[model samples]
Target: MEKIVLATSQIENIAEILEPENKNIWAWIGKAKKMGLSDYALGILPKLRIHEENEMEGLWLSAEEPEYIAEILEMENNSISLGKVKILELCSHAVETLPKLKFHGEYVMERLGLEALFSEHTAEIPKIENNSIWIGKMKRLELHFYAIEILPKFRIHRENVMEELVLNADSPEHITKILEAKDKSIWIGRVRKVSPIEHAKRIKGKLDFTLITPDDQEENGGD
Candidate 1:
């Protein structure tokens, strides 16, 4: 069998190739790590992904070929939010191994460092901008299917905040795609009131959310 290596740009092309299917195949993605070709490069590619939504744990297998396996991964987007664990991971030495291209590595380190500081001093923890409360779905992506990478999101709150931003974060009955669909139950933070793009855009949407500042901390775990 031939080995296949993927790059960030190539993964974008690959991302479009996978769609949800009933074959019991899936690919779980974790950004900030194991994204794009990071899995292939970092020697951490899963031999198979678990179809948790399918009532199976560690039951799905990757394709025999590497390229084919990547295709299989593109199909499933089931994610788990190890909320607090992610926090610890970010603040620890694991971050030292992050990719350095485009300052991506530096950005995460800075974010985690800031989070470490916030967790120690803040009255309450806020979910950061890039972080999520939705940990994906327990079922397949059927009625709930949407994408947000193209949208120009406006930060209701400012960055580098010294004040605590309050947000009512929660997780609803929707399946996540690219995002973790983070689990907000474990979160403790705040969010600002966003302008009414439509009255419900801020308070309600496909999924519920929690509050976090441009600089805040997750508890001690994450996906």
Candidate 2:
């Protein structure tokens, strides 16, 4: 009987520790750490919503396991907060796997966040409506080696009211494919050509390339 009572008390204590409060996530993280709990254990708490810039910041600072953070953000319902969370420099895996999470409905994230998180891995992330821009919060990330894979995913090629992106490729063939596909859908800054002079000249005119085209290859291309 005494063991049962202690167990009941422990359950209540955990419930209080894992209570869903959007504002004090950082504080809870500190408390949970003191109690020798893994940062991810908090992720299983139902109704836990992290929907603020500060809360996102706290999670980034405290959580060591990014997969848990990915799961926590997946439960977020606020579009505005989701926008802030995705741009964070978590692992490529965390950002790439977000689209596969079971969201409440169609969760359209800000395109800029996608640009930052999935720079080269865009093809790996499942399709989501990525168009909104949260002004004054633009982030710039260097191109990953395989960023050229973005050529086949047309969603990122949509013309935005405001955009600033740059691509650098090792081969002219890779750069050509990206430039032709982008076709001025968004503002692409001067591409740093590393292949050779002649290869550079081939894409020079297309470098300032603008004109959106249907990604006819999207259906057949494998990510």
Residue 92 shift from truth in candidate 2, angstroms? 3.0
Error of 2 at 39 (Å): 12
Model 2 scores a C-alpha lDDT of 0.32
Question: Model 2, range 1-223, lDDT digits (tens) per residue?
Answer: 0100011212344455455554375344333211212334434333333333321221221233344345555643333233132233323333343332222222222222222233444434324342322222222323333343342332222223113333445455545444564333433322212222333334433333232224322121101
Lowest lDDT 10-residue stretch of candidate 1: 138-147
Predictions in order: lDDT? 0.23, 0.32
> TM-score of each candidate?
0.20, 0.36
Q: How do the residues 79-189 of candidate 1 rate in per-residue lDDT, one tens digit apiece?
A: 321222111112111111211101111111111111111112211112123332222111111111111211111121212221221221122211122233334322222
